[model samples]
Target: MGAECCNKDCLKPSVIGYGVVAWLSSGAALGVGIWMLVEKSTYSALLASLFYPVTIYILIAAGTFGFIFAVFGCAGAMTDSRCMLALFWITSFVVFAALGSTGFLALYYHDNVLRKDINIRQAINESETNGLKDVINMLQAEVSDKLTFCLLMLSFLS
Candidate 1:
């Protein structure tokens, strides 16, 4: 009985630690997904195809479900509830699958579609909406600033 209790005590801390890590990762995913959704105009306007929006939606869904599952994991670990732990594990697998698919789709697009389809110059020139134009200009200014900084660094090195 004493050995069994010690084993459970060790397991409980490990499970709770895993739950904490999951919580942090899920939060980061959720934050990025929401940021992407909020800035959809900037990204979607630049992209020629529907791939960006689809990936964003998938990311959002995965993050949402991941967060919920993380909560279940923490609760289950704290309470030592078998049912809650089972639910947490099941939901976590689904979230992991969603995230994995999103990653694969992103890699595929980066290799095959993004290079051929995305024309930043054309996107800026053809931008119909004022919002899109603003976003493009903002991005351009940021790039220019970074370039200027790089040039300054090169000059100092020389």
Candidate 2:
């Protein structure tokens, strides 16, 4: 509706922003998939899992997940399929809302269903990390103490 250009030579419809973002999403998906495959570690999974939902959102839009939504949007713009376009438009609005404001809140809220689940997950992840750190710390302290004792014994023996 708020198209910036209507020139016959303009290949892009309504907004250049959409095409740019579609490609950006495509690139990000490729990057994440590559990172997951190549890295293959626990920390990588943790980091990737943090953005899991966003990845799902991107998948819903287009690219490797299929161009269904985006194709629908494009077709709608071209007036070929109003219903599919309308559906994509609704989702697009939700997605933009989520990205712009508290569509994130609309999609997810800290006071609602996910809050408890997120809290539990975060707590568990943190505890695991802390437990690992504590084990490492204890091992370090024991090593230090043993080293100190060995030096003292060697001094006396000498």
Candidate 3:
């Protein structure tokens, strides 16, 4: 089928290019998701909600969709099927838009949280409950100082 389609000039050069990009990018995303799952799974178990299960799920979902779309895109290109290509375009657009929105919201919330006059550690320390106090202390100790510094710089620049 692919040979017939190729011989008949059914697949455009642009379609092939798009298919290649989809395959490469999807493969890369899948690799990253697996890496994150391995690297962060321990922290996820230790901190539960604070460790960001939602974020981890999103990463995995992104990779899964990427792989799915890549396969669809390649099949569409190979068989010269308009339906598959259309589905790929629509799904990929939606995925990109969702990721973009999530990223923007994360940055916005982080900046808002850090803009408060009181320091996070100070607030955590002054809280009345001992249970939360211990968790917050653990979180503070585990978090990288460089990440905080980077966020501060970003907030200041903006």
C-alpha local distance difference test of each model: 0.81, 0.52, 0.67
Q: Tell me the lDDT of model 3 at 1.
A: 61
Ranking under TM-score, best-scoring first? 1, 3, 2
Tell me the tens digit of each residue's lDDT in model 1 across 1-158.
Answer: 66876787789888888888877888888889899889776656565566777887888888888888888898999999999899888888888898999999888778557564445556657867666577677878999999999999999999
Q: Tens-digit lDDT track for model 3 on 10-53?
A: 65666777767866776676687677677664444233334244
Q: Rank the candidates by lDDT, best first.
A: 1, 3, 2
Candidate 3 has a TM-score of: 0.55
TM-score of 1: 0.74
Q: For model 2, name the residue pairs that clash.
A: none
Worst 10-residue lDDT window for candidate 3 reads 42-51
The list of candidate 2 runs beyond 4 A from truth reads 1-12, 15-67, 97-158
Q: State how far residue 62 of model 3 sits from its true place (Å).
A: 1.7
Best by TM-score: 1
TM-score on alpha carbons, each prediction: 0.74, 0.34, 0.55
Per-prediction backbone clash count: 0, 0, 0
